[model samples]
Target: MIFNRKFGAPGLQRKKLAIISTYNENCGNASYTHVLKVAFSEIFDVDVIPLDLFLLQKPQPFINIHADAHIKSICAKLKNYDYVNIQFEAGLYGATAGAILRRMKWLIDAAPNLILTMHRVDVAETTSLIEAIGKSVRALRAGPLFHHFRNKEFSVLYHNIVLHCKEQSARKNVWIKVHAKREHRVIRDVFRFKNVIHYPLAFLNKEEQKKVKALPKADLAARFGLPQGSKLFGVFGYISNYKGIETAIKTVAQLPTDWHLVIAGSQHPQSIKAYKDVDPYLESILNLIANEDAERERKLAKLARVNHYLEKTEVVDERLTKPITDRIKFIGSLDDDDFVHVLRDIDAVVLPYIEVGQSMSGVIVLAMEAGGRVLGANNLSFAETRKYFGDTFERFDIGNHIELAQRLQAEPLEVEAARTAIFETYNIRNSVALQAQVFEGTYKNV
Candidate 1:
């Protein structure tokens, strides 16, 4: 009757962990959450409560359960569970201080043993409230600052920081988990959250890693229709603008014609409707075309007029002025197997993201498991993760196309180093063990 004593929960089989999320959403958050639920279910009796944004009542049994009002009923259903884990992002609930507060308050009233996994923790422009107020006052000096003080950025940055602080303060007993060590540091040091734990996203096992590498080397020329003996660089994730895909394409244009870049995944189904401006994918494509066509700026003008939606994948967008139609492949969304295959085949993986705030990338973790050489943007999240990365890992300035081109042209780094790194740091067994330790520690200390 002793199940998972190593977790220190001697009778863990009797305990249940409820993972609340928008269960079937197309975003990475949903996909990652699903995987975590599967991982956790092996240790604890788990339930996935379909909790999308605010609603008055359950629209088809937990599918559209209200973020604010319907929490009491959701809690009643989850009352048997020992703990509740909420997959939290500000915008996911509702992108307002009042909205997030209302939702969180509902959860607090519903469940006492709560664990919060913050996908993106908001770090204010200025750390202290005094500094924020000072900045706001300074903006008043620079001519009528009505809409936004200095910049037209999120007007509620100060508001969000305050609300987040209040949320953490109220949820002192709640276990706060973040993906990277840096996030742990930021939350603990800057925000001063006492109840915080840092563990990486659980990823592939050694066996799964072997499967990808063991899968007979992909024939790029034949399978994906690239030129023979050509270098294939890849960016593997759903298409998003901040991913610096424009930077990726621009870098590809700089490389030799034989060198091809495959945008491994399609536009995220959610992203097509998410952004207020142009689609992030289209924005990236149009930016590339704008750079390429200095004279015949027809594509640029036409695309600029488009408020939303690009029905066609304009050839000029992905080609990069190099007659590299066959070279630059926008092979739409792929299944898990194909994604792994692409990771295995690619020479190097470029993460040229502009401003990445997340603790760790699901894509980067997968690439590490597949043992692909990674060239990442110089940022804290990756820098901290670098400790666990091998010699194959390299970081360049964010949005620097030239440096990325130079690195991509270099010989592919040996995957053995990364494979070794993967086994040590990003393996599934290790992640599970860590979670067990965390779960036990939470109860023991409290």
Candidate 2:
């Protein structure tokens, strides 16, 4: 049977390829890895090795037995593969670098054809070593010194080690790869690595696409106990200060009373504290009251009236956080199906990110895939994604709550139109085919 299967095959050799990542379970990274696996599976027997280095887990035995030794073990296993491709982010820089160095050493010892793809790097906007240290110092002075110092030390050590790997690779003939054009440009500008290659990340799989399409919008609202006609707005992924959830809340307050905002995903306790600390409603009310008083003193009665009206309009917002009985819902986390269903019911996906890198948003992608429109902060990545949908999506200035509210209010009809356009452009088949091309190119080059 095996002979018959190979009888007609001409000059076929199944190459073994290894793709490495620390955050393989993370949605965005996982999605990208999944696409690459599918796209490369035909030509190469792929092995996806998810490193446990950066994960929030207990330290593994071998990992604790010196970094170089752990890396050697990893390389020893990976050495048999025909091509090794590494996907790296600064989150797991030390362990990732150790693994890369070990692989490089093994390649130098015997194996070659190693490809390093930098997913996220240690830089100012993404993850800066210096800034982390600075923040750590401040954190130390503010509270616990020993814990903060240790954490900062680990980060600094990891960053230095990763930097060593990067410099070493550049000095040697190792090829460094990046996904986006902007990433490539930044890498060139910062590190000036000669062997950098620009390759865009892949899209979702057929099954994942189907899952997105099969999302039950109405069912999701029902599960969450949200009213049927509520104008739902979704904010997905890990909650963070920079994600602009507070801004989204303020925007919701500015909307009509019937409108509802759903903050999805598990909030980091720090973020919850930060939100409580900032208290956007109070901030807005104070700003309004101050403005109104100033206007009245200036004899600008019309302006004062406008400010007063705004304040009055926002009074209902205080009721939002009364309890679960209150309309505003904070669903901590959702399963994939439930998330999809919720996404479908949403009128718009709001990503008011203050800072973003080359990260392709799964929330925006899912919203678009589920036939919902997107309202993203004005950024290069968002702009690139918006290009596919044309006029369907709208962008708001980052950190500008008033502008975000105005855009949200004005663009409901436009969002629906954009939803139609988004479906046409980001259809799963086309996205998959484009990803397949990327895989084909990468495989051929490798």
Q: Across residues 1-446, which tens digit of lDDT does each residue of candidate 1 receive?
A: 11234543564455688887777765567777777776776677778887655352222334433444455667676567777788776566654455555665566456546667776664544344455556568876523343233222332442344345447547444666778777776667776666677667655766777777777777765677776787877887777766777777777657877787888776655454534677746775866755554533454456645623655544344323444344577777776667766776787788887764656777777777776777888866677666565445777898888998987777756657645745665666666555555555533433
TM-score of each: 0.75, 0.64
TM-score, model 2 to reference = 0.64
Superposed model 2: Cα runs more than 4 Å off: 1-11, 23-27, 54-69, 95-111, 122-174, 205-217, 268-325, 336-341, 356-360, 380-392, 411-446
Estimate, for each residue in 1-446, the C-alpha lDDT of model 2 and write its tens digit. 00112212458777777777643454455656666676566556888876655321223446545644544566677767776666655444243333444344443333234566666443443335556567768876533444444445444443443454455564443455655556565556665554556543435434565566665446455666876666667688766655777667666545665566677876442223433665443355335434433543454445457769877533333323333223456787666556666666677788988764544455766665555667889876666555455655668888787887677667464355545444544444443333333333432332
- After TM-score superposition, the amount by which residue 95's alpha carbon in candidate 2 deviates from its true location, in angstroms, is 8.5
Candidate 1 lDDT (Cα, whole model)? 0.64
Give the winner by lDDT.
1
Candidate 1 TM-score versus the reference? 0.75
